[model samples]
Target: MAFDYDLFVIGGGSGGVRAARLTAQDGHKVALAEESRMGGTCVIRGCVPKKLMVYASEYKESAELAQSYGWDFDLGPFDWPKFQQHLESELGRLENAYETNAEKAGVTIYKSRAVLKDAHTIELADGQTFTSKHILVAVGGHPNVPGLENADLGMVSDDVFTMREMPKKLMIVGGGYIGCEFAGIFNGLGTEVSMFIRKAQILRGFDDEARGHVADCMKMRGVTIHTGCSPTEMEKRNGRIWVKGSSGHEEEFDAVLWATGRNPSTKGLGLEEVGVRLDRGGAIEVDDHFQTAVPSIYALGDCIGRVELTPVAIREAVAFHKTVFGGEPTKMDYDLIPSATFTQPEMGTVGMTEEQAEERGPTLVYATAFRPMQMAFAGGEERVLFKMLVDKETRKVLGVTIVGPHAAEMIQMAAVAVKMGATKEDFDATVALHPTMAEEMVTMKEPVRTLD
Candidate 1:
């Protein structure tokens, strides 16, 4: 095939850049197009900046604890503008790194939106057309703000990163990871945060016990979490957004972030003209090989809605390249994908939840909740929880979830074990790393001490 390129990828975020670079590695000509920065939402506006802010916000609590740890403290007020400037600078650095790495790896980078011309062609916004043997869409997902009264007063998580000013009172309208994270971030930063959620608890998809622990922590930290509540209408009065709830309750806030959900960014990419199947949520329908309805095209990352996590996107990119151009077929396995949230206490989970394990068979769930040893002298009033979901019959570990300091770092190694089918013996056989918080995960006398 005399193709303009072997692979033409759209939306140069994590997934697009990975796919383009991997295709180029296989000696195939590849080009990727992006409307925004190369680092995507995670680096620019979402995870990366948010996590830094989380740490910064926690400094207030940390400083308060320092006084009890034999240290006199003189903590100054946080300058939001200073943090924003630093965040923007860091985003620029990461974006530049991705660009340089892509160029060095022989991937042509296009800075524009891509409109699909057909099953195998896309026209860049700049009026350049490229025909490729494979067209991969990695546009990712965007924050979805539903149609609500006074919607203009409400913002999404994306806009919060660029908030005009630090809000005095914030009302978050959802209880998902995005909303809960911001609730903790702003509350830790001393903004009165009120979260109104429709469900009985936040983090609806996570394990029930972990979710309960977070909810308890949130309430204890003075952030008001309203469950079984929905906003009936919203109005603005005297420079604030006034929210009316279903139970005839009313509240006002300087900002309302509606982190209800995200939908795939496939609306204007011309999917329908080429018979690309999309689910009810607008997620691209793909087979096990990640091939779309159109044989020559594929899609990955948030847009595919398989895992919707960042690492899963990277994994899909590798599998797609190996399958198509590298003369090897690879299918992505989503069994034990790892993920983390940057809420106040932090949380990380991998593999199946206890609810998910129950679907397969009767499961043995091991769990531990306690204060970390490091915190004894640190004077922090936080709890570290470690949960392991295992199969009672087979003794295979089904999942690992941790909520505490460095949860993300510790969970990754445990994720590898779960993915590789590690059992109780595997964990017991490994030696403890000593005096570290991670050692707690392995040294629990009983996974969960019961009242037997």
Candidate 2:
């Protein structure tokens, strides 16, 4: 059967781009279609831009810390427009890089929206259709804003990049990492920030103790955290958004940002019409190999609702290419995947949480919390928590969580240990570096408590 291409990707996200590039590099015909920018969410709107903003927000504290170190200077107001301009420029550069890489790999680039016409046929917005031997969907996901009065009046995480000015008083809804992160960001940038969470704490589904520490740190930083509550209504008047809280309190703010959650972007793609199985969350249902029920079609990344991380998606793409094109079967390993939340204090986590470990079997918990030397000497009240969950029977480190500065960097190394199935003895046997927060991970020899 003759086809227009050997592989046709319906997205230009990390997963799709990697797949297209790898397939083409493997001497196969590949074409990738993306209606929007090439880098997809992580590069264009999500992680990259968000981390830049996090860095920008941290400068306020950076300046304050410098003052404590005998530096004298009054920082000026944050230049949001200037930062935004620079951010957009950088995004443009990245988008161009994605396109360039794809073109260099001999993959055709279609700057158009694509839909499934059948298991192997993709129809573009321009009324052009192309057939491929196999199809891959990696369109990614979008922010899920619930239906509410004047909901459009609020902004999502993606819209933060487009904001022309910083809000004086910002109301962030939801208590997830996205919401908590922006709370820290806006608060650090000198905004009177308030967060409304339906749950009692932010960063739900994470280690309870670690999440509690993060929420406490956020509160100490002057973020007005409203737990056990949410916004019921939003109204606009006098250029301010009036939010009616579930507690029957109404307040107005310069802007409202919704970081509630994300839904798989499988809308209007005609997946069902073509016999692609979709999960209840609208994510494409695929097997361990990422092959959809329709063997000719496949999906991965956030669109499949499986470990929606940029690196994970890229790995999945690599494995998919190795399996289909290179004739080597491969499966993605989801265990011990390290993740970082860019909040004020930051959080790095990998493997199971304490609760998750306890549920599996007998677990020994090694936990420590103390103010870091730098912050302590500088007369700061901030603290860091380091915890390790180990299997008592096997002595294997089941999970590791750190909440404090440089946690993201520390977790990367910790993840290696967890992935290698390093036991508690291995950590204790290692020599500790002097005057460092990371040394705590190795120095904690005895279990604070054991769970059977």
Candidate 3:
């Protein structure tokens, strides 16, 4: 069979672009089609822009903290238009980079949506057809907006970056990382942020103590959190969004955001029609090697529902290339992958949760919560938490959870030790760096409680 290319990638996301570029660089003819921006979700709409906003939102408090430290300055109001202009420019630069890199690697770039017409054939949005020896799908996912009355009146996470004007009062629904992070972002930006969470606490499935600490910090920061609540309906009324909650409470806000969740972006890709099996959540199902049921096709990243982080997606792409193109048979390691939530008081975690470790065997838990030197010196009530979970028998550190400013930064280093299977005694043997919040990780001498 004559094939137009050796490989055809159906997405231009982090995973798809990497796969296409690598395969092309390996001297195989490859082509990639993207319906929208080349940088996909992470660069165009997700982490890059969101982290920039997080940084932008923190200046207000940073200025106040500076004043407490005897520095004098006045923090001006947030200028949304100016910030957004820069953000758009940065994203455009990133998209161009992705495209240029792929082209340099000798991959054909198509600015159109591509869908499967058969096991080895793709049909583009312009009715163009191409056949390939192999196909890779990395379409990623889309934010889910629940089916509620006038739900279209609410915006999703993707809509946040291009918002014309910052809302004076913002109502956010959902208890996941997205909802909590945005609550902090808007509240820090001077918006009256209110959160409606159905769960008892935000960040479900995370370390309980850490999540509780985050919720407390959010409350102290002036974000109103309504736990045990979810929106049942929403409508526009008098130039505002009126939301009715499942708990029968009603409220009005200038803007409402539905951060419920995201679903794999596999629609109209003609996946199942070509014998690609999809999970119940519409995520493409793949085996250990990221190979679909059909041998000629493969899938990875968010569309496969395996670790939906951008870095993880890139790793999967590398693994896919090694396995399929390089003959290395590599697989992405999902263990001990640290993650962070960029809230006002951030959270960083790696390895097992206390509950998961306890379920496996006896465990030892070491924890501390206190105001750090900087915050204490500034007379701020904010406290930082450091917790380590250890196996009672092996004495190995099972998990590490941190909640405070720069928790994300601290967790990255901690994850290295955890990934190496460092024991609690190894941590105790390391000398503590004095007067540092992270020193607590090494300084804790006793387990607060032992789980049997």
Candidate 4:
């Protein structure tokens, strides 16, 4: 049967937009529908805005560092409104770029939500229906606010960008990267930030030593972290929000943020009715090639519950295009994927943690923690950590974890080495760049302890 378009993509997120644009560029008719902004979460409200805020928040310390370095200046109070205005303008520019690129690639753009009506049919929010040869769903996820009494009084990550003013006292819930990163951001921005984490440590899935270093740094930076705690209820009282924790501790704050987690934005997409299977967490079930249970329908990115990063989504989109249209089947590589948490000090990691590597085989761990030259010279107690995990038998570097200034930047290069299966000897053979925090990665000649 003839179709209205060769492909219909149900989202305008990084993944969806890339897939739609690539397919259209291949000379196939492609159409994309987005319920909200063009750049989806990452460009619209997630990483882009968050990173900008992180930069904005760091100026207070930057000024102090400058003063310690013999530069004279007074750091003024953070102007939220001015920064937010610029942020909004930047986001608008990015959204326009996404739309312009898609249109230039000859993809039809629809500013409405699209849902599946059948294996090959999609219906827009306006009740307009269209049939396609293939359908791709890349709707991303949203911050999850736990269901509790007066939970609506609390804001999620998405609500942070829209806040008219920064809260004087902020109570953040959850221990994941979102919670920790925002804790650092708000605290740096001069908010009295308090974190209620259900886990023993802030970053549960990260390396134990690295997370410990981060938690210590966050506490030293004036973030009151209450580990082994979670909010059981929230209520508005006397112009403030009061939260009762699972540990029976109660606190009041000017604002409450629930960064517990995120759920895939899959509701009302009509996937179940169209014979597409969904996982227990409401994520769409897709095969290795990103093809859904129904052959004509495919889903990727956060909605599929895989690696929920923007780069991963774009890679999946490229892989999908190559597999379905380019006649070269490709699968996304999930190994050696580097990630970072933008807390006060920051952390960047690629490959297995000491715990994970030990579980696989005998491991050798090399680690160092010391105040860097800049921080030490400024009379600051902040320390940087560099750790490398190696396989005892194979001598291959199993993982690299860094916690300190530009950890994210350092990890990108470390990821390249790890991806190439560089061994500990290869790292050792590289000459150390003197007086640099990164030099420690190459200079750790002895294992702190070998785990058999």
Candidate 5:
């Protein structure tokens, strides 16, 4: 069954949606195959819903912050059901928006699972096979459940957002970004959160100082963090799950969330049947331009298993479309990307960390941590930390990270400097924004320390 189209995309998540719609906009006949909902993991499960919970959790923080602003009133107990209803309604609105937008863009969408019967051809779940000149597997990633005793008792990131009722206690099983973010959401909503991680620290690959500050802030906010620990067994005891770990520690909780990590979402896609190469992590082996071993097939997003953020997926999808269809093509510059953790004291970073920059040569680390000016009267003791990595040789700013109010917003501006390959002198040359937390980027006076 050959279809007349220039491109076909599978998995209508962030990457899939953009690839299909944008390619269609370029006057290429494009078809998208999605097994479930059209909107990808980011819209339905990952980023959108999680951020909403973050915003919902912040209202509680706001009341506490209100005390310092000379406003006093009795805050009502949070209604979990009310929030769940609102979240569901908002999700409905988003689904409608996605459908309307795709239709307007003239993309043919197939609401069925797609698998490769042969290279350059996909079989729909409903017994339809469509062949295209180009096939993109943007299927994204899913929870990586570990194999441990009572591992079946642990819930993944997907289960956390769909929780209808509140828990007496939640013992989250992973200490990575997903687990840490959920820990913050649970703690902020007044649930006791205990975390277990295999490494000495949470967010193991992130900048050490920023990670340490976040771990401390989370601890202060009442999240019991357990490092260098792995749960060995689990059992149901007294209406709770009893978790016995190798650390010789035990805890009981209403439920367990295993935000341990995620792997590429290419399950049952039949890649092996068509000779597409897979990396160690089951990620589609793609070349520099995101082309798989078979050039007719392309893959991006979590399916490629690196830089699994939504924006990165979008960039990959956009670039893939442009390279194949657009007259001029641009390869993705993996560097200069910025991301933030929605956890307490919300951390944001762009470019090299102090540790990363040191591999080049001697590097200067400019760091400052203090109470936010707005927090001085807010009664809450929340603080912001800013760190920048610069080459002592060139004084060019390599990266910037902020862990405080609106850290994400701050790092976005800093990313421009990083993308332009700005040095330390570039940061020094720019005038400060004044009285805003963002000004900290241009206001560092001393090297907190130099790293080699």
Candidate 6:
């Protein structure tokens, strides 16, 4: 069978770009199509830009803390325009890098949306068609916003980066990581932030204790969080966004941000016409090898709704290349993947939570909470949490969770230990570094609680 290319990738996201580059480098005819930017969500609007905003927001706290260390200066208001200019410049550099790498690998770039025409043929938005031995779908996902009264007045997470002016008062609806993170970001930037969550607490799927610690820290830092209620209707009045809550409370704010949820970007890709199976949430369903029901097609990353992290997408791409092109069979291992939430007191976790572990079998939990030296000396009430979950019979560390400063960095190191099936004794044998929050990971000798 004659084909225009050996592989035709239908997205330009992290997974799609990596798979396209790898397949082209393998001396296969490869082409990738993207409707908008090259670096997709992570580089353009999601992780990179969000983290930069987090950095910018943290400086106000840093500046205030400097006074305790004998530093003197009045920090001014946050300059969003100035920071946004720099952010756009950095994003441009990244998008160019993605293009350069793909071009270097001899992959043809199509700047249009591509959809499956048949099992191995793709049609683009601009009346172009290409046939390949195999087709890959990696379109990722998009923010999910419900249709409510004046909901269009609210912005999603993507809109936050491009906002023209910083709001004096911001209302964030939803309690997921995105909402919690932005609440901290805006609050630290001196915006009065009010978070509305329909649940009793934020971070629904995380460790309860860790979630509690972070929620407490956020409240102490002046974020007004409303739980057990959500916005039922919204309206604009006198230049302010008026939101009517489920609890019979009405509040007006300068801006309202919705981080409700996300849906897979699998619409109108002609998946159903080509006999590809999608789950109830419209996420493409694939087998263990990421192969669709049709032998010549495959899907992965956010479109599959497995793990929506950028690194996971990149890994999936690599595994896909090895399995299909490299003459080596590979299966992705999804165990013990560490993740972090960039909240005020950040959260990092890997493997199973205490609730998850106890549900499986007998488990032993070690937990500690204390004020860090820096915060203690500065007369701050801030605290750090370190917890480890171990299987009682195997004596293996099943999970690790940290809530406090540098939780993200510390959890990366802890992930290695948990992934290696290190036992409680392995941690105990590692000598503790004195006067450090991380030392708590190794120094918690006794079990705080045992679950039978």
lDDT of 5 by residue, 225-313 (tens): 88888889898898889998789999889999988788888768899779899988899998878888887899999899889899999
TM-score per candidate: 0.95, 0.99, 0.99, 0.99, 0.97, 0.99
Q: After superposition, how far is residue 213 of candidate 4 from its true place, in Å?
A: 0.6
Q: Where does candidate 3 stray beyond 4 Å?
A: none
Question: Whole-model lDDT for model 6 versus the true structure?
Answer: 0.93
Output the lDDT of residue 330, model 5.
71
Poorly placed runs, candidate 4 (over 4 Å): none
**Weakest 10 consecutive residues, lDDT, candidate 1?**
443-452
lDDT of 5 at 316: 86
Give the least accurate 10-residue stretch of model 4, judged by summed lDDT. 143-152
lDDT of each: 0.85, 0.94, 0.94, 0.94, 0.85, 0.93
lDDT for model 4, please: 0.94
* Model 6 C-alpha lDDT per residue in residues 1-452, reported as the tens digit of each score: 89999999988989999999999998999999999899998998799999999999999888888988899989888889999999999999999999999999999999999889889889999888889999999999999887887899999998998999999999999999999999999999889999999999999999998999999999999999999988998988999999999998889999999999889999999998999999999999998888998999999889999999999999999999999999787888998899999999899999888889889999999999999999887899988999999999999999999999999999999999888889999999999998788999989999999988
Q: What is candidate 3's CA lDDT for residue 157?
A: 97
True-vs-predicted CA distance for residue 185, candidate 3, Å: 0.4
Q: On residues 328-396, what C-alpha lDDT tens digit does candidate 2 reach at each position?
A: 999999888999999999999999998898788889999999999888877999999999999998899
RMSD (Cα, Å) of model 4: 0.7
Looking at model 4, the pairs that clash are none
What ranges in model 2 sit over 4 Å off?
none
Residue-wise C-alpha lDDT for candidate 4, range 267-332, written one tens digit per residue: 999999989999899999998889999999999999999889999999999999999999999999
